[model samples]
Target chain A: MKKTKHKILDMLLKHPDIHLSGQKICDVLGCSRTAVWKHIKELESEGFKIEAIQKKGYRLLSTPNELSEARILVGLKTKELGQHLIYFDSIGSTQKETQHLAEDGAPHGTLVITSHQMTGRGRLGRTWSMPKGKGIAMSLILRPKLSINRIPQLTLIAAVAVYKAITEVTGIQTDIKWPNDILVMGKKIVGILTEMQTEGTNVKAVIIGMGMNINANKNDFPEEIRHVATSLKTLTGKEHDMSLIVQTILFYFEELYLRYLEEGFSVIKWMWESHAVSIGKRINARLFNGKVLTGLAKGIDEEGALLLEDDQGSIHKIYSADIEIE
Target chain B: MKKTKHKILDMLLKHPDIHLSGQKICDVLGCSRTAVWKHIKELESEGFKIEAIQKKGYRLLSTPNELSEARILVGLKTKELGQHLIYFDSIGSTQKETQHLAEDGAPHGTLVITSHQMTGRGRLGRTWSMPKGKGIAMSLILRPKLSINRIPQLTLIAAVAVYKAITEVTGIQTDIKWPNDILVMGKKIVGILTEMQTEGTNVKAVIIGMGMNINANKNDFPEEIRHVATSLKTLTGKEHDMSLIVQTILFYFEELYLRYLEEGFSVIKWMWESHAVSIGKRINARLFNGKVLTGLAKGIDEEGALLLEDDQGSIHKIYSADIEIE
Candidate 1:
């Protein structure tokens, strides 16, 4: 946080591949060798892994880590998504962080990521397990000029992007699970969390928090979740490129998001239908009102709610509920 | 925050009329006079004013003359609203505090109030002035079961509640300046800043930051803001009770919120229309695309968007824009 340390950081970041000698750094910083060592110690504390050789110099090594600011910024290379990234090694939740960031005037495209979240949560504050370094947990901040009715489409767009990104990078054949999750072979591979800040008729910010099971082994999941949860490495038998996948997600997202703003949902409606799990299948949507409608999954309505037609021909627009394939 | 302090608070709330001596408080709390003195000093630091005489002993005088924690919770009785009110004498902003709290899983109804805001803001990050002891600057944490589409209504409901509370308590008869401001006699008196923390589809918490000019004088307003901003005392020519106004706002909100859940927009729509400066007026809406549409206000749609009917009878829903009365 001091000026000398900030100068050292600037030097390292500017010359990513350069090695700086302790003598040179100490002389340039006008500090003792102990002070230079302390500055490096501070950088290490910030999750920058640097190797100090006796004769050669200090070489900055990019470590494969979770919730490291450098790692997140390295992966996220969009004008919007990477502008600001906040990382927490163990947080209550990433969605909560992004929401807080949005509230504090963190502009559209601010990102929050966390790994090894002790109290990670899902919808309705349900426990969201985030094993150490086994998944890519990230959230995106977006301030769009959108009305309330058009907000649900953001979920659909995110689901589509995640599914596309995972499939493109890992070849996992992901499917849209409606409203919020991504599935592969009847098991959830990814979960999306969307939180918003609104004022009157305008959306203050919409944060899209995503959790993807990337490198977790079967043992990584708890016994209760082993049946319903899966990882990219577990599915594919090899580690997929996380940075590449992140890039593809941001790229596809920017495209989809722009389309969503300029042209509405038609651009990706057919794509979503193709990747969706229950398009033509008979499914039972358990409504919160205690009404169970066993119907064929027709398609998504213009407002992004799932449209289901029953055997008797009554069309039901389900806003939010547990979706079960029968 | 300490056990004995909470005990004293409980005693004060339970017995508001009677005064308690230090010895009696010591007896009630099972502590020594020195311990009571230490606790009193700690409470004083937290802004709880206590009177101690040579023979009369100690009596809880006024809450530390602060909008901070002590005074915020003194007479506060709420099942939800401000159940956990954190007062900051001077903060970057209450929205920032609430955001941090939300990220740390602050309870759904947690409230943050600041005596003076260093970085108070309005919609789209505009500046909002918050001078000490002259305004009620607070933010409430709420978790609404909104699908992003219904999120905007919360602001309108808050605006209506603010208008009603200001007029009823201060007798100012303030007019709703559409969307989020309350104006008294064509001068701005209150500004509502609603910020939310949300992820993909789940809303974690919305911090409703409101800055209401309470006892500000004419000289208190900055030269630039003098023409625009006015306080309750400035309009009423006398200082008004802030606690009464706070209670009134919360009461109206609870009622309007209940009615909103039961009957939807119909409950508060007319109320907003009655106090608003938008309906049936000729206004020019400055669109983000640099296009301005001059139209007569029809009313708000179901999703709380401004419904504008042009002279040609074309209905347009204005989402985000600056509407000026022409």
Candidate 2:
């Protein structure tokens, strides 16, 4: 049902300058003229401004702030990433849906995205909550031909990609926290979660989930996290176009991802460290086993582990921990 | 259908010396006496010997040399490893099925075993072939509280468990190969493949697959692998009970796995080194990137990576490689 609508919309959105006739839409979509008319009416009902003429056909005048495959695909210039996008109005977790898709042989660069996440999740079993139509909740499926040890590098790559996208889209400065948190004004604005499915040392699939607080007000966050969470609208004092932001992020992510595949993590590592907030700073890391160590953050190693120099002047590799800047 | 048969067989196998009445079986299984009699006839046709006394009920006389859930569970002594067992006569791959089960929330220590594997696989995209009904193909699911870097040690632990089980069952000495193979008299006898599912640094589940050649004749193997592969029947002069071997392996695996959880991989590392075939010998290791190096095998490190001392006396850690004894 929605597939035909999306196809018709794609034709209309691609050539917004010229009107696409109903006959042409039917011919391209292999449907009846009545079906095309019905789809155009439905698109209009969904806040799409479509101008329909007697014989000139349909012209896409404007699109709603809503996310659609047609809207995203029209502006997305990636070769493969975002080429196959699955959009939802609301979903439990894009990560879970993308994992299932990857297991069922979803291609590399397949993206699952939603406007709202009811059961959003973060690293270490944390819950992520966002208001409806106020953020970008997405999971990208990657099938890289790499070993399990090198998978942690992808999370850092995602951090760099999102950092570039955020800075480019809004011209706002942001810092990438050690593992996978993007901060604005010392408050988190985005979170990235990386999950992997592997067979022995061979990697089968990796799901990179990103949840951002884009247009939400500061009060939109839960009371407990209000002090620590900030959104783009709050930082910029205005609401940014969500579709434009999503498209810009996908563009930069595809660029960095392809570069990482051809070369290695060296370039991405440099980018990540340059945008990192904790590098060369005094910090306290709460390890996964409930142990805390205060050290000077010396940056990341080749394997993506945090290199921490303690008071005793010995460097320690920190794998998974929560960092606090001192 | 098989579940009812397994339950009835479990009741009979648990008390082999006592006769179970038809009414008692019907009452316990929540079925009619006709159903019970039908299941008993089916079991009998499947090679289970039962003596029907006109007045005293049905008595089990003996069992066949076959693999069944009840047959293995009756003699199995484990806390939770084999407490939940899924048995099959033939399957594509036990590893695949066990991975699905683990994803669907199959508990830790869940075991998926089959009599044959049509599409068995080894490390680095290698195919493992075995004769029907003449080998042990099983996958165990484990949910541990460890990071992904420490997962390679589970492969070594599985090797040690299988080593102890084979030595205790057949009194046939075997040597542990570097990563996950068992060699008897310089011939490959067992292959273990350890796979993991993880979210960032948290471990979700690890599936350890063991495929062993038990009772196949030398000719049962394909022409390509016959020179490199050997069965228990070829090593010893007779066929071994597949059920007994399964029970013994599960027993030792549960013990060692629990110990690994409480303590670290240190104990398993020492045990593995004691039985390793390449520990103190000169060996050629073909690395993953098509490089070969000749070095002295100087045991394993705490993380289960093979340590090799080169001719220049520098010790190199071998993560994943094909080792050949020189």
Candidate 3:
């Protein structure tokens, strides 16, 4: 957002009920009254309902329904994360966009977000579709100086971050499904896909893509996933602001990510295990090699690999798999 | 190379000592005599010397000193490693190009080769410069269905392949330096870097980039690395054919890569250990996190991590590090 526009929005938001005169806005912003009126007009065009009176000046009635760079950044509380945000109305995949940005030497905490993704991506080459303006599809680019083996731990860290953000915003707790999903009552409310680009064992970038069904109704999802997916609005019977959710997630992500960097994966591993839904449950893991291992989920190892105790009481560290509670 | 050009080159290379008439070339290629003459002219322009007799035929005198697509493919014995090739006279970096190709759905074993690299890359953000027309810079894209943890093994496998190829071609055996470099008599001659793009522990594509100082002299290298770097021409006191070495390397790469997919890393691990110079030697390994551990280098484990036994006799698994023999 431009500096003057952000200042105007801040003043109007600070006092939502009162109208500030154009001369007062001009004095606060140190600009002409014509420039103040022009900024007001611009904000109105972006879906902000502004009431204009002959003597009472302008009152900001409501904000835009859509997400904008200004909207996500107005109250964002991060030092570096999301400071260099690239917002999109619609895109093929935020993950791909972040990958390209990372390749082009994007900063550490750059965020690429879209209101709608035409071709969303999920873990292991699965298709993820989200309704326009009803879901949050965002990819955060991180350049952590860690070994390649530790890259998987970032997924668990992200799951924990999203879990906390959603719970804090809605006052409704959500269960993290092992590595990447957030489940509400056995239905998936969020999906997280972490992709990495590495050179030999040196990591170039890690892009964490998260998609949450924020305001979608029962019929908004595709038929196949409708029975298995739930939304915050569907569960809470109200519309939740997506920009706030994005800001909260970014806030929590910065916090946990900094903690992981300073301390290690120990703190993150404990938090992940605490929120994981698959811990201590009887589950069947379909391994990448087309073999299924039926066992009891014994939580993740230090490296974030799922530890499964098979029927023979032997523990196997499953690196990549699709697990289901049996 | 175009189809007809490849066919013409193959015919000429088959009978290098004798002359083949344009009429015979036309009949074999199913093209016109004028077309055959045009191909001969094209070959001549690419540095192939041909002697045209009055009535007899055309005799192939010598091949090009520079690399060409037709030259490399003529006697190549690989199944699919270099079957689909993207050749360049000079490129920025074959690794970067191959990464882009992999993103665009390049098939497994797609090879990208360049006679020269403007900006060659070494592991851990090092610059690798090669003299024009004197080195081999190639990147191969492989889509292996393996867990992400196993991706590091591909670098060790590539080292073994390059070791075998150089020994077979130049008859001067080289030493595999733990993970990436191939050294001959305490000097670096070849470097291999394996990079990967992954989605949440699932391997998307692994690009194995190999850069070899094939025919460079001492003065061709930069002043800082001149004493530390040696090439095939410097070691053997004769110029080795670059195309023949490339073909040999690709042949061995395909054989060993297929064996890895079929059997496992056991075979490749054994091969790598046998040729490694760091095994059983006292070394200082500078890890990625800036801590240097001085230890005796044991052989690599099953997953290709270097097993280092420190002064206290405690063994540590070194995943990504630079080792210096003490």
State which candidate has the highest TM-score: 3
- Candidate achieving the largest DockQ: 3
Docking class of 2: acceptable
Per-residue alpha-carbon lDDT of candidate 1 for residues B136-219, written as tens digits (9 for 90 to 100): 778888877765567667788999988877778666677886677888777888888776655544566677889888888899
Rank by DockQ (best first): 3, 2, 1
Could you tell me how far off, in angstroms, the CA of residue A292 lies in candidate 3 after the best superposition?
A: 3.2
Candidate 2 lDDT over B1-326, as tens digits, reads 23677788878877788899998888888999898899889889867899888767888887766676667876578988877888887899898788778756699989999987899887765788989988989999999888787988999999999999999989999999989999998999999999888888678899999999999999999998889999988989898878888899989888998899899988999999999999999999998789998989999998888999999999999888899999
What's the CA error at residue B36 for candidate 2, in Å?
Answer: 7.1
Between prediction 1 and prediction 3, the one with superior lDDT is 3
Writing each residue's lDDT as its tens digit, candidate 1 over A1-326 gives 23576566655655668788888888877888888788888778866778888876776775433334544354354667655666666676777666666766687777677656666677666777756777778888888877656777888888888888887877778888887889888888788877666654567677787887887888989989989998888888886655466667887888788888888888778778888998899999987667888999999988788999999999998887778999
DockQ of 2: 0.43
Interface RMSDs of the predictions, in order, are 3.0, 2.2, 1.7
What would the per-residue lDDT of candidate 3 be over residues B8-89, giving only the tens digit for each residue? 8888888988889988888877999899899899989988898988678988898875677888888789878888889998
* Candidate with better lDDT, 1 vs 2: 2
Higher TM-score: candidate 1 or 2? 2
Candidate 2 at A90: error in angstroms?
Answer: 5.2
